[model samples]
Target chain A: MSRALGIEARDRRRAMLLTAPALVWTLVFFVLPFALMAAISLWQATATGMIRTWSLDNYTAFFTRPAYLGAALNSIEITVTVTVLSVLLAYPMAWIIAEEVPRRYQRLALTLAVIPFWTSYIVRSYAWSLVLSRKGVVNDWLAGWGLPLLDLANSRAAVVIGFTHFFTMLLVLTIYASLVQLPPNLRRAAADLGAGPVAIFRHVVLPLTLPGVMVGAFLTFALCIGDYVTPQILGGGKDLALPQLVMLQVGRRADLPMASALSIVLMALVTLAYLAMARWMKEPGK
Target chain B: MIRFAVSATYMALIYAFIFLPVYVLVLFSFQDGRFPIPPFKGFSLRWHQAVLSDGHLMAALGHSFVVAVLSSAVSLLLGFLAARGLAHARLRGAGVARGLITAPLSVSYLVIGLGLLASFNLANVPLSLMTVTLGHVVINAPLCFAICASAMGAPQLAAERAARDLGAGEIRVMALVTAPMILPALVAAFLLSMTFSWDEFIIAFLLSRFDVTLPVELWSLLRSGLNPKTNAIGSLVFLVSAFAVLAAELALRRRA
Candidate 1:
C-alpha cells in the first residue's frame, strides 16, 4: 500500500514537473505582464517620465477626454458594423458551399474563398488602400462607367469595408462547420411537419447555427476592435480607432500609463463581449 | 434555369469581391510606373528587382524568418510537454492550469504586445529580437497547447500505458511512444504556430528595435512612399504564405 502511495506521489510530482515550465512561463509572461499593465494604468505619464502615483488619474482622463472617448465609440461602431455585416454576408456563402457545392469540391471552394486570408494582414489592408484611393482601380472603373467617385479612401467606411472583408471569411468558416455538423434528419423532420423551405430554415437551421454565428461575431468584435493596421492604413488618420489611439500614446508620446489605460479599456470591451456571448461560445459537444 | 443563373451570378460576384484586392495588388506589382494605381503603364520586373536589391528589406525578411522559426519551436516544445503532462496525469487544478495555459489565445495581439512592452519597460529590458520572440511565444504557445491537447485521446493513452507497462522509462515512454503517436498534431501545431509568428505584426513591431521584422519594415515603406516596390514585397509574402498554407492543407489531408 505504501508502494502504491509512493507511485501516486511520484506521478503527481512528475505531472508537476512536466507542467511547471509552461505554467511558470504563462505566469511570468502573460499574467504578470497583464497585472503590470493594469497597475501602470493607474499611474500618470508626465513629460519627464511615468509617475507611479497609484491613482485613477489615467482612467479619469480616459473618461473625461473627448478624443479618447470618441475613439472608443468609433471602435464600437466599426466593430458592430463589421460583425453584423460579416454575419449577414457569410451566412449565404457558407450555406452555398455546404449545401450547394458537390461534396468533393466543397473543400476546394472553401479554400478558394479564404485564400487571401493568408496574405500578410498589413499588406491586405494596404491593398484596400490602393483599391479605394482616388486614382485607384475602383475610381478608374467608375470613371470608365461614367459614375461618380466613391470618396471612400480615407474614411470610416473604408475601415469598415476592410474589416468586413476579413471577418466575413472567418465567419464563413465557423458557420460552415456548424452547418455541416447539423444532421440532415432535422431538416427532413421539419419538412415532413409541413414546413416549407424558408420555414424549415427559419425554425431549424437558424437556431442550430446560432452558436457558431455568435462565436464568429464575438471573435470579429474582439479582433476588429483591437486592430491597428486596418484602420491606420484605411482610415488614413481622418478617424481614429481605439488601437490607433493606443499606438499613438505609446509611439509618439511614450506615455506608457495612457497606453496601458487605453489597452485595459480595449480589453474591457472584449471582456464585455465575451460575457455577452459566453453561453453560445462553447464547442457544440462541450 | 433562372434559379441556376441567380446562384451562379451570386457566386461570381462574391468570388470577385474576395479576389479583388489580391488581383489588384499582384497586377500593380508589375506596373512599370512609380505609381501603383491604374493606367497600367505596362508590365515590368523592376519593382521585384528593386525589392531583391534592397538591403534593409532583405535583412528584415531574414529577421522575420529567424524569429518565426525559433519562437514557434519554443512554443511547440512547451505546449507539447504541458499537453502531454495534463493528458497523462491526474493533477490537482488541472482545469485551472489548462485555462491559464490557453488564456492567451482569446486576447488580442495588440493588448498582449502592449502588456509585454509595458512590462519590459518596467523591467528595464531593452527592445530586441529576443524580446519579440518571447512575446511571440506567449501569444502562440496557447494555440499549440490547445491543438496538442485536443489531439491527445484514448488510443494514445492506451499506447502510453502499454509502453509504461513494458518497462519503458517515463522519458522513453514520451520520446518513443507518445511523441510518435501524436506526431501529426505536433507538426500541425508547429506549422500553425510558425505561420502565426511569421505573420504577427503588432507584437514584433512594439518589441523590436534596430532589428525590425518584415511587417514593420513594410509599414515604414508604405508610410514613406506610394511605390510599386511595396506591392512587389507584399506579393512575394502572399506567394510564400499561400505555398505554406497549401502545403499544410495537403499534409493534414494526407494524414487524415
Candidate 2:
C-alpha cells in the first residue's frame, strides 16, 4: 500500500511537470492577451492613451455607425464568396493531382501549386494590383484587343482575385492530400458498376473528399475574414474591411478601447462562423 | 480522349495562372521601364542598382534576418524542451493540453498582433524590435511545440524506461536517445518558424517603431502606388525566401 501510494504520487508529479510549460505559455501569451483586449474594450480611452471608467460606449458607437458596420459586413461577404470559390477551384485541381496525373508529374504539379504560396503573400497581392490597375498589364492587353478597359484594382473584385490567387494553392494541397488517401479501387468500382463519371463524382468522390473540402473552406474563410493587407492594397482605399478599421482605430485614432471593441466583435463573428462550419461538417447528411 | 485533352489544357492554364505573376515580377525587374508592369522597354539593371543603394532597405533586411534567425532559434529551444516534457508525461488531459498548444497555429496574425499590443500596453512594456521578436516567439513557439511533440509522442515508452534502467541521467537520456529521434521535427519546425518570421508583417508592423521588417517596408512602398524599384526588390526577396523553403522541403522529404 505504501509503495503503491509513492508510485502514484511520482506519476502525478511527472504529469504536472510535463503539462506545466504548455499551460503556462498558453495562459500568459494566448489567453491573457485576449483577456486584456476584452477588458480594454470596456474601458474609455483618453487622447493620452489613458483608460477611463468602463462603459458600453465603444460597442454602442460601433452599432450606431454605418461605416464600421458596413466594413464588418463587407468582410463577411468577401469571406463567404472566397470560401465558395476556393472549394469550387480546389476540388477539380485536387482531383486531377490525386487521380488523373502520373505519379512523377503529380509531384511536379503539386510543387507548382505550392510554389506561389512560398512567395511573400503581400508581394503577390501587390503584383495583382499592378496587373489589374488601369495602366497595367491586363488593361494593356484589353486595349490591344479593342476591348473595354478594366480597372479592377482598388475595387472589391480585386480583393476576390487577390485572395483566390493567394489561397487556392493551400486549398488544392489540403484537398489533394485527402483525395489521394481515398482508395482508387473504390472509385474504379463505382465506374465498373454503371455510373457515369459525373455521377460517380457526385456520389462517391464527393462524399469521400468532403472532409478536405470542409478543411479548405474553413482555412479560406478564416483567412479572408481576418485579412487586411490584401484589401488595403487592392481595394483602392474605397472598401474598408474590418482589419483596416481595427488598424485605423488603433494606429491613427490611438483609440485602443475602440479598436479592442472592434477586434472583439470581429473575433465573435469569426467564432460563430467557425462553430457553424464545425456543426455543418459534423452533420454532413443534413 | 476529349476528357484527357480538357484536363491537360486546364492544368496548363492553372499552372500559367500561378506562375504568371512571379514571371512578371522577375521580368519587370530587368526591364528599363519606370513602372511595375512591362512593355518590354529594353533591359537594364537600374532597379537592382537602386535596391543596392537603399540604406533603409539594407537595414530593414539586416534587422529582419536577425529577428527571423533569433526567433526561430529561441522557439526551437523552448519547443524541444516542452515537447520532451509532453512526451514523457502520461497526463490524463493531454489532448486538451495539445489543443491549447496548437491553437496559435490557427489564430490569425492580425488578431494575435492586436492581442500582443493590448497585453504589452497593459504590462507597460515599451514596444521595440525586441518586443516584436518576443511576439514572434510567443506565436511561433507553440507551432514548434505542436510539430515536435507530434513527432516525439510516437516513440515507445519502453525505450525511455530502458535508458533510465541503464543508469543514464534524465538529461543524458533525452539528449542521446529522444533528441536524435525528434531532430527531423526540430529542423522542420525551425524552418517553418523561420519562414513565418520572414513573411510576417502584421505583428512587426504593430509592435516595432524603429526597425521595420522587409514586409512592412514593402507595404509602405506599395501604399504610394506601383513602383518598378519596389518590384525589383520584391522579386529578389521572394526568390531568396522561396529558395530557402524549397531547400527545407527537399531536406524534409529526404529525411522522411
Candidate 3:
C-alpha cells in the first residue's frame, strides 16, 4: 500500500511539472490583467493622472451616461451585422469549396482564402476607403453610367464594407475546415436516400457544419466589437464605437478609470460570447 | 443552364470582391496621384522615393523586424519546452493547462494593452523595444504552445521510447529524436509568432515610449492623412507577409 501511494505521488508531481509553465503565464498575464482592470474600474481618475481609492463611481458614471451605453450598444449592433453578413457570404463559398469542386483545387482555394489575411488589417480598411470613396473607382464607374453614385465613404456603410472584406475570408476558411472534415459519403448517402440537393444540404451539410458556423460567428463578432481602427477610419469620427471611445478615454482624456471600466465591460462581453460559442460548437479537432 | 450561368457569375463577383482591394492597393502604389484620389495622372517612382527617403519609416521597419525575430525565437523555445513536457508526462491537469495557454489568443488586444499598463509600472519596465518584445512573447507564446502541442502529440511516443531504449539521456532524446519530428511544427509556430508580432498594434502602441513599430507609425500617418508614400510602404509590407506565409505553408505541407 505504501509503494502504491508513493508511485501515485510521483505521477502527480510529474503532472504538476508539465502544467506549470502554462499556469504561470496565464496567472501573470491574463488573470492578473483582469484583476487589475477590475480594481481600476471601481476607482476614479483625477486631473493630475492620479488614481483615487476604490469607489463605484466609474461604473455608476458608465451606467448613467447615455453616450457610454450608446457606444456599447453600437458595438453590439455592428458585431451582429458583421456576423450575419460574414456567415451568409462564407456559407456559399464553403459549400462550393467543399461540395462542388474537384480535390485538385482545394489547396489553391485555401491559399486564396488566406492571401487577403496576410495583408495588414488597417491597410485593408484604408484600401476600402480608397475603393468606396466618392471619387473612387466604384463611384467613378457609376458616374459614367449616369447613375447617382452612392456615398459609402466614412459612414456605417464603410464599416460594414471594411469588415466584410476583412472577415469574410476568416469565415470561409473556418467553415471550409469543418466542411472538409465531413465524410463525402454522408452527402452521397443523402442523395441516394432520394433527398433533393437543397434538402440534403439542409439536413446533412448544414447541421454538420453548424460547429464551423458558430466558430466563424464568434471570431467575426468578437473582432468587430473590439475593433477601433475600422470604426475610427471608416466611420469618420461620426461612429461612436465602444473601442474607439475606450481609446479616446485612454489617449485623449487620459482617464484611466473610465478606460478601465470600458475595457472590463468589453472583455466580459467577449468572454461570454466565446463561452456561448464553445458550448454550441466544441469542434476541438479544427 | 441559366442557374449554372448565374452561379458562375456569382463566383466571379465573389472572386472580384476578394481581390479588388488588393489590386487597388498594389495599383495605387504605382500611380502618380499625390493622394489616393483618382485621375491617374501618370506612372512615377516618386512614392517609392518618399518611402525610401524617410528615416523614421525605415527605423519603424527595422524595429518591426527586430521584434518579430526576437518574439518568434523566444515564443518557439518556450512553447517547444512546454509541448515536450506535456507530451512526456502522464498529466491530469493538461486540459486546464492547455486552456490557460490558449486563453491569450481569444483576448482582445485593447484589453491586453490596458491590462498590462494597469498591472505593471512603466518606470521600472520603461517601455522600449525590449518591453515590446516581452509583450509579444506574452501574447504569442500561447499560439506556439497550441500548434506545437498538437504537432508533438501523436508522433512523439515512438521516437521518445526509441531514444530511451537506446540508452540516450532525456536531453539527447529531445534534441535528436523529438526535435526532428516536431521541427515542422516549430517552423509553423515561429512563422505565426513572427506574423502576430509584426502586425500587433495595441500592446506595442501602449507599451512603446520611444521605439515605435511600423503598424503604429502607419497608424499615426493615417491620422495625419494618407499619402502615396504610405501606400508604397504598405505595399512592401503586404508583399513580404504574403511571401512568408506562402513559403511557410509550402514547407509545412512538404513535411506532412
Return the top candidate by TM-score: 1
Pick by DockQ: 1 or 2, better one: 1
Which window of 10 residues has the lowest lDDT sum in candidate 3 chain B?
B118-127
For model 3, residues B165-188, the per-residue Cα lDDT tens digits are: 789876788789888887887887
TM-scores, one per candidate: 0.97, 0.95, 0.94
Chain A TM-score, candidate 3? 0.89
What docking grade does candidate 3 earn? medium
Q: How do the residues B174-203 of candidate 1 rate in per-residue lDDT, one tens digit apiece? A: 899988987878887877787888888999
* DockQ, every prediction: 0.80, 0.62, 0.61
Candidate 2 lDDT, tens digit per residue, B1-256? 8888888887777777777778777778887877776477988899999988999888888888989999998888777776776677666777787787778777778888999998888788998889889889888989888888777654535676788779987678878887776677777888888988988899999999878998888888786778878888888889878887876777568667
Off by over 4 Å in 2: A1-15, A284-286, B153-156
Model 1: DockQ vs. true structure: 0.80
Which should have the higher TM-score, number 2 or number 3?
Answer: 2
lDDT of 2 by residue, A137-256 (tens): 888889899999987878999999888877778888899988888888987899999889899989988888887788778888888898888898888778699999999998788999
What TM-score results for chain B when candidate 1 is compared with the true chain B?
0.96
lDDT of 3 by residue, A136-242 (tens): 87898898899999999999988988898778888888998988899989989999999998998889988988877887899898888988888988998875999
Interface RMSD of 1: 1.0
Compared to the true structure, candidate 1 yields what TM-score? 0.97
Q: On a 0 to 100 scale, what is the lDDT of residue B72 in model 1? A: 89
